[model samples]
Target: MTASPALRPSAFTDAELIGSGRRVAEIEAQALQSLARRVDGSFAAACRLILASHGRVVCTGMGKSGHVARKIAATLASTGTPAFYVHPGEAGHGDLGMITDKDVVLALSYSGESDEVLMLLPVFKRQGNAIVAVTGRAQSTLAREADVHLDVSVEVEACPLDLAPTSSTTASLAMGDALAVALLEARGFTADDFARSHPAGSLGRRLLLHITDVMHAGEDVPQVSEEATVSEALVEMSRKRLGMTAVVDAQGRLSGLFTDGDLRRMLDDTVLDLRNTRIGTLMTRNPKTIDARQLATEAARLMETHKISGLIVVDEERRPVGALNIHDLLRARVV
Candidate 1:
């Protein structure tokens, strides 16, 4: 019997993989740097065109460029620019009706001579629509015909064979991002506005959700009067299932908070009896609280900073009006 050497899955050396990755990254980074230096009056003109347009910005491209254009449109739309992607191939097949003179057309092509994209230029010009071209060839038909041209030329493709649209696509996407971000800043787009565009996302929950939206209010809030015994507090805590009770003064204002941990501590004193102990004696005085109108993110931060899992929501008069715990925040996706 002979022993065999252990077999590995890969046929290529680690050095080969690392070298290819580094080369691609270096080429892309250099391309971005070059584009940044070349951005001039034309880039500003493109931004102003979109800002001044009375209708949506129509982004169009073909093949891989189309994919990048779609993403760019989404980023622009989410960041406050009214934009959408229209396939150049479909534009001549009746989708052309989607474009109007009031809208601006942003056409993207690596070679700047995509027949499908160029076919729509005449129609756009006839309708008095503004055209912004993003292309690698500065002198191509698309560039010459556009009202504004954003040059995204790359000296070489990240693809080793130089046949695939690798670095070209990266440059185009990055340039699109630059444009969208510049417009976003100029429009004074805020986080709240971004959240509105992404209402189903976690960012929306953090930005739009208030404590009152997720907190248990009214009778659902576990509470005990200052005169209540520890046993009575335990009943309220158990009934509410929050593991804690807000202890209020005779005027119904928040005086303190008592939690299961407090009960445990009281039990540790052999002389104390839960049934006979007053909750006021063992409750934590002036516990941390949040306003009902405060953002849920603030509540999450308060709970995290105070090393507690729950919070009592109070009114302007310092009266306990609601209750929430880490679980509530987790359920709301605010934590």
Candidate 2:
């Protein structure tokens, strides 16, 4: 019997794999760069069309392009632009009603020849809806029927077999991101606006929630007179469980603060006459404070900047109204 060809490792090594990866990177980079150059008057016109529309941006596609369309719709919606995705196959089965005259349609197809997508073009046109097409073939049926065509053609597929949608999908996704960002800039979408869109997110807690929302109010605020003994202040701190107690004057304004760190320092120096020593003698004078109306994130920063764990929340009259610590911020998800 003829000897089977011996299996042997070639001299070709890791460098070849890395080199192939670099080549693919270079090609995709070039494709994106070409896409950037294609952003001309048409890009601005597309933004204007969507911005002026009263209805939502209805995004639709097939296969991988459909996945990209869904993501783009989500991004646009979250960035102050109303948008939603409609699968082309589903559109034929009753989803077509989602599109109205006021809506603008964004259709994605790599070959620009998806039958389901083409079938809906006449309906969209008859409804008086504006259609924007993202495709590799500008001359394809979908593109030819569209009111505006965005060319997202790539030089070649990243797949070695040249059969899969790889670089094309990346380019399309990047283009969609570019559109979202451009519209965001044009609409002057601020961080506050983004916070409103994501009220349950961390950014919302940091931006929208005030210090009063998380601070301990009423009986929870630990307070002691300036003339009170150190022992009395310590008892108040223990009762409040905030690691500190505010020392107030006869006028009920904050005068100083006594913290656990202060107690430790006092212990290291010498035993104080707790009964005779006033809390004001050992407290930190003019302690850093925050307004109740201030953002919780600002309160957190103040604590970090001063290297302190807690702060006394005060009103316009400089009276202690509440108390907050790092733990409160953590619990509130503002940190």
Candidate 3:
């Protein structure tokens, strides 16, 4: 329990500073490894208890453990588990009414003797709710009273004085993440399912945004008939401002695509006439296209894979139903 040496600005060295950081990381990594090995049948029991519960998980803790509990609750909620954090202090002050008989209480206390957390256990027991406790002490009150106990003990703290809850807190959080991932897998949660809960996040834009959501549709899509000239296709491209024009046949099915890059390359032929030359003769046929129902992220992938900057959203019959470019994806924040 010796105190850490005081770090004065003048006494600091780059190697010593970096070494301290590395030591902390090393200690926390070792603690997490220990935690992984100890996740046994009790872990399964805890997951089962949570899964069987009809209501949300009520996570309660005190101080630092409370912060971890809040994060755990958020992770669980976003990963398809119904859960929320309830401060033990607040629960003692009437917040306990939020918990129902169908809910499961996940209590966190590193020492397994937090008075605030312990105080609520009797109430939960009387309410006929299951208790899942996370603690560092195996023989403590919180552990003894619980239906399931997850041991998150670490040999020493990263703090030189061995007093701060550094390694122990890291272990607790890692354990919480482990539980969340296990529950997520058990429920067969998918990325799309996660995106539903995080619609405002970047992942949501990538997964939940369909090509139709961001594509230019109806007359907004740049298009011209195959019988049209290269000059006429350029008019459609300019008027629609899509940097490309889909050259479709009389049936409104895509025949080819003409882009700004085609216009640049067409300049290589000095004798080519934009007024008389047919757009179909200069257009790129069998170009990369996407389905309107596909994820917008898939469109970005298609563009990046082909080193192209635009895509045409086509229907099953290869008809141009919509049009979009990298800029459109950028606007939608899908790129």
Candidate 4:
């Protein structure tokens, strides 16, 4: 005879689920706090080894530790520490060739007895390469063989089953960040250096892009002499398509600005003569201006704060050299 189906268990309440999550976070946070106090000479030695290495930092690990190892490698490389992750499982096949005497190997293991990683120790020894190990077991074979060992031992895992690697992995990741940051500081890595590596990112655009790079220079700039008629200024604005025109003095120095809104306000009058009206009579005096060499991000902020759509780039003598609008910033990917 067929057996009756087993009853399904009730789902956990929201309060119960949230409580479990909080408990896990608290445990992991406490583990990191404990790991902070254990930072000693060995950590410094690891940083020094990576900083002095002429070649890239080769990070390796197995399983969960391998994931954290990849992240550490990325952080190191991004912060000017030249690094790459090598999988121990793959190293035994052919990836071991990636490691060299000039490179430093950073290994991560919770038990410090990962056979895949331990198997590469002999190769590292034969090549005379330095090995920095981040592990929980200080007396494990991997730790004992390392040139520098960073202790990331945790008393308990955040896992309710007590078998998963939760707390230990967090500690290892924290230690990796500590190493990367220390090496970054030692190498004197700057924001400009970072921007160069991440030129496709928003931070790179903000830091490396100049106003002149995104502005319309030469004849593209809409402008009219202070004595030019309103009709002439409108024609220049229409031809340039910037929706605005700069009013300059006899010396070609910027004196005022006339925008499309200005024309609309002037048209509200009982009668207006665009051909006979001088631009300087109705232009806003002492308009906003920015230096050509300034950062494009600064231009964005200026436009935002002033609620204007365009700006005039000026030289040392306050002469109009270029003009730009919000659309230019958008096109340059600086917005």
lDDT of each: 0.92, 0.91, 0.92, 0.93
lDDT of 3 by residue, 189-295 (tens): 99989988988879778779999899999989898888888889888899999899998888989888999998988687666787898888888998899999999
- lDDT, model 1: 0.92
| Candidate 4 runs further than 4 Å off | 1-10, 201-204, 262-277
Query: Order the candidates by TM-score, highest first — what do you get?
Result: 3, 1, 4, 2
lDDT-based ranking, best first? 4, 1, 3, 2
Q: Give the deviation of candidate 1 from the true structure as CA RMSD.
A: 4.7
Lowest-scoring 10 consecutive residues by lDDT in candidate 2? 2-11
The number of clashing residue pairs in each candidate reads 0, 0, 0, 0
Candidate No. with top TM-score: 3
Q: After superposition, how far is residue 156 of candidate 3 from its true place, in Å?
A: 1.5
Total backbone clashes of candidate 1, pairs 3 or more residues apart or in separate chains: 0
* Residue 211 displacement in candidate 2 (angstroms): 2.1
State the lDDT at 330 in candidate 1: 94
RMSD of each: 4.7, 3.8, 2.7, 3.2
The residue-by-residue lDDT of candidate 2 on 1-335, one tens digit each, is 76555645556679998998998888788889988898877778788899999999999999999999999999999998999999999999999988889999999998999998999998998899999999999899998888888999998988888888988998999988988999999999998899899888877787799998999999999999989999999889999999999999999999988899999998999989988899988999999999998889999999899899999999988899999999999999888
What candidate 2 gets wrong by more than 4 Å, as runs, is 1-26, 201-204
TM-score of candidate 4 versus the correct structure, residues matched by position: 0.88
Model 1 regions more than 4 Å off: 1-10, 201-203
